[model samples]
Target: MSLSGKLETDVELKASAQQFHEVLCSRPHHISNVSPSKIQGVQLHQGEWGKEGSVIICNYIHDGKAKVSKEQVEKIDPVNNSVTYKVIEGDLLNEYKSFKITVQVTPKGTGSVSHWTYEYEKLHPGISHPETLLQFAAELSKEIDSHLTSAK
Candidate 1:
């Protein structure tokens, strides 16, 4: 089997596409305020928030376990409402040689749709696809959507 793979999922959100994209690119730290149970905190380590090449460490919970990831902002496309992050260090690197995550939000009527993509190369074929991680992302998106919708 190939050691590299990609997985993607789309989540429907009640918040506008601009709002969703802005939250991720401009103020990702607010995610903890929206979903404290899923995302413990997002701390900027280098550069600045929303800027390319910046680094942030995210503390989160997955599968009932707390985990951390240090990621660099690879790209931020305001026109496309997309943001890409490359994992530089984290628990996920234990099984995968490299991991990249991209999120894009698109307008849909008065609401929006958030697309999450995960690309990774495994260290060995023994590792399974990160389906659980995608599920975690989907749930987290829903939580953030709920908070955004309620706050408005």
Candidate 2:
């Protein structure tokens, strides 16, 4: 099946969209509560954070085994409150030809809508669409919202 998914969440727009974008794109590792049990750590590999061409390595557990994946920032648009990252190498390489994930924020009344999109091409028709990935994005959004709510 052609793989694609989009998840959206509404959150306080108090912090500039750029700020949230920076946290998601660069400082994801800074977020402790939102990280999944599978994820052990994340590290910046090359280039500056929140910039195009920057790379990050994510260490994770898959099937009860540790695995590492490399991803590179493909685009950043502060004005649009969007950032896109492309998978460069990792275990995902075995299943998908390519993967690009985009996070976008747009104002909605007093809050903002965070849109997470995943675009990918499965190596085989048997590969299922990433519903869990969308759930992960939703959980992250909830964590961010809760953090902000508690800080206020």
Candidate 3:
């Protein structure tokens, strides 16, 4: 099957769209409270955070298991409140020939909409669609919203 997916969530964050974007784009490995399971660490082999062309290595938990992935910042549009990261190495590369994940925020009233998109090219036809990946994004969005709501 063709492995392409998009997941969107409306988050009522007390922060501005830009602020939310900053948090979303921060090195996931360095953030402490972004998820229920804390990120173990991050190693950036090249460039810097939130900048275009930056490469980041993130270690985190998924399904109660630890996983690591290497990603590169493909695009960062602060004006549009969007950042796209392309997976270049790690476990993700084993299943997908290429994968790009994007997070976009659109402000409305007191809250904002967060859209997470995963575009992937499966390495083989037998690979299943990445529905679980989308679900994970939704969960992360919820966590971010809850964190911001309580911080307000």
TM-score of each: 0.98, 0.80, 0.85
Kindly list the per-residue Cα lDDT of model 2 for residues 60-86, writing each as its tens digit.
665567777799989988888888889
Report the C-alpha lDDT of model 3 over 24-64, residue by residue, as the tens digit: 67645535456747456666778877789989887867666
**Which ranges of candidate 3 are over 4 A from the true structure?**
1-14, 27-30, 36-38
By summed lDDT, the worst window of 10 consecutive residues in model 3 runs over 5-14
Candidate 1 clash figure, as a count: 0
Worst 10 residues of 2 by lDDT: 1-10
Pairs of residues clashing in candidate 1: none
Model 2: residues with Cα > 4 Å off, grouped in runs: 1-16, 33-39, 60-67
Report the poorest 10 consecutive residues by lDDT, candidate 1.
Answer: 143-152
lDDT of 1 by residue, 1-152 (tens): 79999999999999999899999998999999989888999999999999999999999998899999999999999998999999999999999999999999999988999999999999999999999999999998899889889986
lDDT of each: 0.95, 0.73, 0.75
Candidate with more favorable, higher TM-score: 1 or 3? 1
| Residue 12, candidate 2: alpha-carbon lDDT | 45
* lDDT value, residue 57 of candidate 3: 87
